[model samples]
Target: MKINWKLKLGSRKFWALIAGVATSILAAGGAGDDTTLKVTGIIGAVGSCVVYMLAEAYTDAGNSGGSESKDSAAE
Candidate 1:
């Protein structure tokens, strides 16, 4: 049976999402007093890595496609 995740999560996920957003606000405001800077730094690092990997993959695919076209043209 396929369960509807949105219906199952409902308000629980909604509240949790809200709390997460609020926590981010506090961290951005520099009010954590504990792990604010560390949390933000970790998030930034992970985001940057994800973007870098995606860009590299796309560029490699494009390069491979161009090489194939050049080979076909020369044949």
Candidate 2:
């Protein structure tokens, strides 16, 4: 069986992982207060949504025979 790591970026699990990492970074930075945690959660949610949208757009473009590259979009 072969695994494609790139495809995982479009998964909710990957987004949740990103959110978890963001939460950990915030805690480590001494911003573990309730308000800060809420703000971090909001930011993580927004970030994940943006990533998902971009991934969807990329997939759509590819399916349409467009030559859009993820690297270029990231920049």
Candidate 3:
């Protein structure tokens, strides 16, 4: 199967997920003792979920070829 690697790399959701993973790793690697790093990691993970949801919503809306009015309303 052909994978759309470009699409994945271009996605904000993908970047968010990467950031989340990086932060989580940092937190686990001795940085977790620091409250700020722990908090940052948690926030990064939550932000990734939010970004993924938003990205999926936009992708679905675009694919459905919905009305511009609906899109404008969302904005």
Candidate 4:
């Protein structure tokens, strides 16, 4: 089955998993709380934008035709 990029990108669970893993890795490397928090926040912020762009591209291709912004009620 094809992954729903939009849903995955917006998923709190997905983001939480990413944060957890990053925190674990940083902690294992003996990073301080401040560094870990800052890195995690930056990752989440940049990741949000990147995932959104990728998902739009993916779902647009999935529709296979016109570039209608169907999900956006205002559009």
What is the C-alpha local distance difference test score of each model? 0.64, 0.73, 0.69, 0.81
- For residues 23-46, what per-residue lDDT tens digits would candidate 4 score against the true structure? 999999999999999989987887
TM-score of each: 0.60, 0.46, 0.42, 0.54
Q: List candidate 2 segments past 4 Å from native.
A: 1-32, 66-75
Model 2 RMSD, rounded to 1 decimal: 9.5
Q: After best superposition, candidate 2 residue 25: deviation in angstroms?
A: 12
| Per-residue C-alpha lDDT of model 2 across residues 1-75, encoded as one tens digit per residue | 887665675576776777788778878888857856797678677767767787888888787664446556777
lDDT score for residue 43 of model 3: 65
Residue 38 C-alpha lDDT in model 3: 62
Ranking 1 against 2 by TM-score, winner: 1
2 versus 4: better TM-score goes to: 4
Q: Give the best candidate by lDDT.
A: 4
Tens digit of per-residue lDDT, candidate 1, span 1-75: 998643443434444454567568977777865675565555555555555666677689999999999999999
Of 1 and 3, the candidate ranking higher by lDDT: 3
* Model 2: how far residue 38 lies from native, Å: 0.4
Clashes of each: 0, 0, 0, 0
Better of 2 and 4 by lDDT: 4
- Which structure is stronger by lDDT: 2 or 3? 2
- For model 1, where is the 10-residue window of minimal lDDT? 6-15
Q: Say what the RMSD of model 4 is.
A: 6.8
lDDT of 1 at 17: 57
How does model 3 score by TM-score? 0.42
